[model samples]
Target: MATTTASIRVPAPPERVWQLIGGFDTLPDWLPYIPTSELGEGGRVRSLTNEEGGLIVERLEVFDDKGRTYSYSILQAPFPVTGYLSTIAVHEEADAGSSRVEWSGTFTPDGTGEAEAVALFHGIYADGLEALRRTLAAGSAQGS
Candidate 1:
């Protein structure tokens, strides 16, 4: 299995960050690449539409509101991988009201090298965290 993790520190409270990303169906609100998300199975499953109009279905494996974390497994996606499990978490930072957001994933490459899979996911996570930072900055600017 290949794995990767990426994290970013944002100038916001953990609760606030979690409020934006903690939901199973809230990716569209922050992740621009995921343009739409529809929840099913009472919010346990999420069907996402990517910027390319590709379908990615995922099922929530675990969620912790208090911990500001959630884990999911991808049921279907247009990626060269299988058994994909990912987790996203927000942690309170030592600095006043800042928080650290971490995104990590583990998967077995399908017809690909482990290093390639790791690089792909690491890039995704890193880019996603950057997008999150931009989103949060925009929201703060708007007094949200």
Candidate 2:
């Protein structure tokens, strides 16, 4: 199993980052590899249509806003993987002008490029976090 942890500080508020993370389907809007995700009651079923249109289906087992963590497993794909979990933490500083975002995940590569997978995870997530900063900076929205 391989693990990756990455973090970024956004000038926006934690609520804003939480909003973006809460909407699983919107990942495709900012993240490149995840073309889309289907959100559910307790978990989500996601389909990642790669750049060349390859499909990767995963079951997002844990989507906990209260706990700030989500787990997933590759149900079907071109690789072998299981028991994947990704957690995102958004916290506001006491000064009330900045926020911090942390992302971590555990993955067991199914004969795929572990390093690439970890890199992709951080890159896409960082981009997504930056997009959230832009979105919140533009204006406020209903809380997630």
Candidate 3:
């Protein structure tokens, strides 16, 4: 299995960051690459349309509000990967009043080389985390 992980520190509270990311259908709101998303199965499933018009289907496996984390599995995607499972977590940085967000995934490359799969996921995670940070910062600025 190929694994990829990315982390970012945002100048916001954990609870605030969780509010933006904890929901299964909120990816389009914080993921710049995902321009549209539709939810089904009572929000347990999400069909995301990326900026390039590629579609990806994912199912929510776990959503732990108390733990400030969620996990999901990719049911279908354009990537040459299988058994993809991803987890995202937000943790409070004490004394700084900020939050640290971590996004990690494991998957088996299906024909696509492991190196390519890892690189693709790394870019995806990094872009998503950066978008999340910017979204939170903009929101905070607007509220002040």
Number of the top-ranking candidate, with lDDT as the measure = 1
lDDT of 2 by residue, 1-144 (tens): 788877777776666566766655566655555665665445467767776777877776667776555556667766444566777677677768677877777878766688877776677567666765666655544333
Q: Relative to the unseen true structure, what is the C-alpha lDDT of residue 122 in candidate 2, on a scale of 0 to 100?
A: 70
After superposition, the stretches of candidate 1 with alpha carbons farther than 4 Å from their true spots are none
Ranking by TM-score: 1, 3, 2
TM-score of candidate 1 versus the correct structure, residues matched by position: 0.98
Report every candidate's CA lDDT. 0.95, 0.67, 0.92
Report the poorest 10 consecutive residues by lDDT, candidate 3. 91-100
lDDT of 2 at 35: 61
Q: For candidate 1, give the lDDT of residue 16.
A: 92
Write the residue-wise lDDT of candidate 3 on 1-144 in tens digits: 889999999999898899999888888778888889999999899999988898999999998999999999999899989999999999889757699999999999998899999999999899899999999989989999
TM-score of each: 0.98, 0.68, 0.96
Higher-scoring candidate on lDDT, 1 or 2: 1
**For residues 1-144, what per-residue lDDT tens digits would candidate 1 score against the true structure?**
888999999999998999899989999888889999999999999999999999999999999998899999999999999999999999999988899999999999998899998999999899999999999999999995
